[model samples]
Target chain A: MTRKIPQIICALFGMTLFLLYFSQHPTARNLNLTILNDYFQIIFAFTLLVGVVSFVKVNLKAFERGEDRSYHLVSVIGVFIMPLLAIIWGIKGDSPFMWVFENIQVPMQATVFALLAFFVASASFRGFRARSVQATILLAAALIMLLSRSTIGDMIADQIPQIADWIRNYPSMAARRAILIGIGLGSLTTSLRVMVGIERTWLGGDK
Target chain B: MDAGTVIAGILTLAILTFLYRDNPVYKLAESLLIGVSIGYFLVINWSNTIMDLMFVPLFTQGKLMLIIPLILGLLMFGRFNRKTTVLSRIPIAVLIGSGAGVAIPAMLDARTLQQMSATVTPILAPDGLPNISELVVMAGVITTLIYFYFSREHRGWWGKSATMGTYFLMIFFGTTFAYTVMSRMSTFIGRMEFLLSDFLKLTQ
Candidate 1:
């Protein structure tokens, strides 16, 4: 009954929402909105809470095992401090919470993403070999694109930008569209499988 | 610089130390970023979702129907307990099922049908010259789709078409990588600008 109950709930809600999409009735629309907007938000928030608890628990356990103790301690402190600040001061623009988010969090996050540039550039230099026809095509396209973004590209040729634009708009776009269709079909089948109780892995068991 | 800017600059420098090697300063900054981000989201979610959606409506407005979701949400904590673990699946099931249900028609409409319709363009231009761009686009679209068809063995003409599809895909990946690097470089440039002008007050 344990697994059965959840399976039943899944099928029932799945079919209901699926059917709800086909209807234009006011009642059906209202039901959809309430479930999606209000219920989903509340439930998802609790899921995030679960995530936080798990993160803290894992780090605390690691800390107990004398693994990178300072890092763990700092992390744990950071996890608690933001909420503490928010609790004391409201989450207004001028509040400490927002201040930390804007200054510390945003800059550090941006820097981390930006750090990838150097690594990717170095990786490309090492790995981007034109060993075959396909490889050559890829290398040429990337070279053209990278050059088109910089001043040297203009110095080299006037038509580099147009060539890059054409590559992006046509061949690249066609590939993207094919991928999107494949993904959409895959999603449809997977969703149907889930709705039909075939995909029960989300129940956390192979059964 | 203000206190916030100074603190931010220090943290930024701390994280940037990772390029040299992972060290104490970089580890500390990385840990703080992870923890603080989780906490920030936690607070934001609690305020925006829990308090506003559940608590306010349940208590002040007396939306008794909200009790259903509130109870379901609380049930998610049952995951920590072995015996009640199965109960946690109920809420997860609801979330997954509803998501799947919504994706069905949405994906069909937006991703599949719209893209298909967009691909069907006029073959000839107004002046009756063959539109070379459209023809190339058509060839690309067909070959790419054929490349994804794995049900049949790729022999003869199919093999050649698949090879062409592969070239287009490679071009896509190359362009994508270039654009990604460009964006990251722009962001990196912004950080350097901040470090030079805002933090150290160094004139270029």
Candidate 2:
């Protein structure tokens, strides 16, 4: 009964929302707006709380198992400190929370993302070898793109940028459209399957 | 220089050190990054969404209907209890159902229909001559779609078209990869500028 009820609710709500999008009635639109703007917003907010709890639980378990306990402790402390700071001092532009975020979080996040530069360079050097006809085409296209974006490319030739733009606008865009259509069709099928209760993976365990 | 700039510089270098080798310092920085991000997100959401939108409006505006979602949100935490884990599925179902419902028509309209219409442009330009680029785009779109059609055996003309499709896909992927590399390099440059120009005052 517990399992069946949620599945039914899922289908009901899914169908309602799907139908609501096409409805012209003011009441239907109002109801949809309320549910989306209010209910979904509130529910999503609590989902973050769920995320934090799950994160802390994993870290706690890791600490208990003594697997990189110090790092886990630091993670937990960092998590707790931000909220504590916000609660105590408020998160205004001049507050301690903003200061920590600007100094600690921004730099860390930017540096982490910046590390991708090294990884991409190393990975491309290994992977971008022109081993086959298709690979050669890819390598040529990539080289053109990279060159077009660089300062040296402009000095080399004006035509390089034109060719690069043509490749991006025509072939790249066409392939992107094809992929988008495929994704749209796939998602539509999956959504319908979920609405019909055929896709019960979300029910999470042996059904 | 203030304490914030100094601390930011140290953390930036700590993260950069990972490029050479994975050490405890890198691990610590990674952990702190994850921790701080979660903390930041949690506090921001609590203030912006929960307190500002939900709690404040509920009390000040006297919107009693807000309690329904509030209860549903609270019920999500019931997953922690083994006996009440089933109850958590209610909110999960609502979230997933609504998300899928909203995404379905939007994806169809924006991704499929709009993209298909875009590909339907005239092959001939206003000068009454066939535009080579438009012809190539049309051919590329058709061939790429054919490549994804896996039910039929790839032989004869079908095989040729699919082969062409693969070439287009390769170009697309390669362009994406190159663009990503460029953006990543820009980010790296930004960090270097911060360290050199802002922190050390070595370059402008």
lDDT tens digits by residue: candidate 1, A86-110: 9999799999999999998999999
Candidate 2's displacement at residue B63, Å, is: 1.4
**TM-scores, all models, native as reference:** 0.97, 0.97
Residue pairs whose backbone atoms clash in candidate 2: none
Q: What is model 1's DockQ versus the real complex?
A: 0.82
Q: What is the number of residue pairs that collide in model 2?
A: 0
Q: Which residue pairs of candidate 1 clash?
A: none
TM-score of chain A of each: 0.94, 0.95
- lDDT for each residue of candidate 2 in B3-104, tens digit (9 for 90 to 100): 999999999999999988999999999899899999999998888888887899899999888888999999999888898888899998998898788779
- For candidate 2, give the docking quality class from DockQ: high
Summarize candidate 1's per-residue lDDT along B1-204 as a digit string, tens digits.
699889889998998999999899999999999989999999999999999999998999999999989998999999887888888999999999888888899899999999989888998999999988877777887898889999988889998998899888888989998999999999999999999889999966
Share of native interface contacts recovered by each model:
0.82, 0.79
Candidate 1 deviant stretches above 4 angstroms: none
